[model samples]
Target chain A: DTAVSQTPKYLVTQMGNDKSIKCEQNLGHDTMYWYKQDSKKFLKIMFSYNNKELIINETVPNRFSPKSPDKAHLNLHINSLELGDSAVYFCASSQDLDGADTQYFGPGTRLTVL
Target chain B: DQQVKQNSPSLSVQEGRISILNCDYTNSMFDYFLWYKKYPAEGPTFLISISSIKDKNEDGRFTVFLNKSAKHLSLHIVPSQPGDSAVYFCAASGFFQGAQKLVFGQGTRLTINP
Candidate 1:
């Protein structure tokens, strides 16, 4: 069984279009996170939520937003997507807000903005 | 600024040989560190972790060594196999903005040749 899963595994769209990626975890974790992996293979954290409350927000652009409906789910929405936004986005979860805990990651959603 | 860094972009090792991956960090406050492995088209999987309090932790064929004085850590895989070929990322967790967050490295691609 998949502990963490994401939808829209591959997305291709034109610039200026908006898109949303969904994530879910069956591990019943308390904390969820959104990370983006750029072309150079740099994985950077964008947002983190604990128990449905926003906890960590990085220096990401205002066009990107993360929403966690519940502890099992965290979704990312991008507005006016740019070519720079073409990267693999990953969803992860941990047992708690502790960063030391092992975070399980989803398969990832590859977003491509033409 | 990038707090975590992996100097090597790639490493090649033969099967039955040992593979070593190195990482460095600029932040002294990081109390915990982790290693992650990612194959193509898959999300990163937690490999091993070490607490700054200790110097080394070993599990199965994988061992992690930490040198807090030099702010360096390394992952050694004994008897490397083809299945072990993947991208390795080093991450550090520490208090930042009143919360604990993980800072990831640029990642090192490990290739085990048969």
Candidate 2:
């Protein structure tokens, strides 16, 4: 079974457009995270939610927002997307907030902002 | 500043040989370390991990070594097979903004040849 899944494997939109990526996990995890892999292949965490409560919010731009309606779902919405936003976005989930817990990641969504 | 770093961008190993991947970190607060493997068009999967208290962890043919004094870690794969060819990422876990967060390296692509 796919423990973590993401919608729209690829997204291409013009500049200033808005887009949303949906993620879901069936591992019954309590924490979900959003990460971005830039052109340099640096994977950085953007936000994290635990039990539908915002827990970790990195120094990301305000244009990006993460929403977790439940423990199993976490979505990322970007407004006024720019060319710099072209990268791969990944969704991950873990059992809890423990540092030793292993996190499972989704296939990732490649976003191209033209 | 990048807390976790994988200096090697790629490594090649002959089939049935051992493959060693190295990683270093600058953050002393990181108590947990993990290695993840990713194939093209797929998400990263957990491979092995080691905690700060332990110097080595072994799982089958894969072993992880942690040196807390040097803030370094390594993953060794014995008798690596062709299927082991993938991108390997090193991650460090620590508290950030009052929540446990994982910081990942740029990844090192491993190519196993027969």
DockQ of each model vs. true complex: 0.85, 0.96
Q: Write the per-residue lDDT of candidate 1 for residues A1-114, one digit (tens) a residue.
A: 899999989999999999999999999899999999999888999999999999888989999989888899999999999999999999999999876799999989999999
For the candidates in turn, chain A alone yields TM-scores of: 0.97, 0.98
Candidate 1 lDDT by residue in tens digits, B49-106: 9999999999999999999989999999998999999999999999889888998999
How well does candidate 2 reproduce the true complex, by DockQ? Answer: 0.96
Please estimate how well model 2 matches the true structure, expressed as its whole-model Cα lDDT: 0.96
Task: Assign candidate 1 its CAPRI class.
Answer: high
Q: lDDT of candidate 1 vs native? A: 0.95
Task: Indicate which candidate wins on lDDT.
Answer: 2
Residue A66 CA displacement from its true place in model 1, Å: 1.1
Poorest 10 consecutive residues by lDDT, candidate 1 chain B:
B94-103
What overall lDDT goes with each candidate model? 0.95, 0.96
Off by over 4 Å in 1: none
What is the per-residue lDDT of model 2 for residues A8-49, given as tens digits with 9 covering 90 to 100? 999999999999999999999999999999999989999999
